[model samples]
Target: MNMQIENNFSYHAPKPGQPEIYTAIREKAKELAYLIDEKAPNSREKSLAMTKLEEAVMWANAAVARN
Candidate 1:
């Protein structure tokens, strides 16, 4: 595998303060999830919105982990 690609695929252990950053990201995502659950009507669109929010959170975490 290419070195850059290998590096990208590797698990990155959290450095000092990184776990705190990850926790903050997750907390904010949770707050948005609560608002979505309370305010959005029960429908397919709302379901999709929730799914996308989950994807956003995963991608955000990956960005922090990889960079």
Candidate 2:
């Protein structure tokens, strides 16, 4: 008899799909802060990050309005 060791890979996510809009917004804001730091002020990437931050804000406001 012969046996071999096996490597492990996983795709099992434990999270549910329920939306936490407020938390989502806060987390996105944190991400934007990181991007701003990485890209710095007045750079092209800064402009892109600013746009994404604006979009996140708009989405958050819409979610709030709906709620």
Q: Give all candidates' CA lDDT scores.
A: 0.90, 0.61
TM-scores of the candidates in the order shown: 0.87, 0.41
* Residue 9 in candidate 2, Cα distance off native in Å: 44
Residue runs of model 1 more than 4 Å from their true location after superposition: none
Q: Which ten residues in a row have the lowest lDDT in candidate 1?
A: 1-10
Candidate 2's residue-wise lDDT over 1-67, tens digit each?
Answer: 2222111222222244324655677677888777687769778878777778878776674545443
Candidate 1 lDDT score relative to the true structure = 0.90
Report clash pairs, candidate 1. none
| Tens digits of per-residue lDDT for model 1, 1-67 | 6988987889899888888888998899999999999999999999999999999988898888888
Number of the predicted model whose TM-score against the real structure is largest: 1
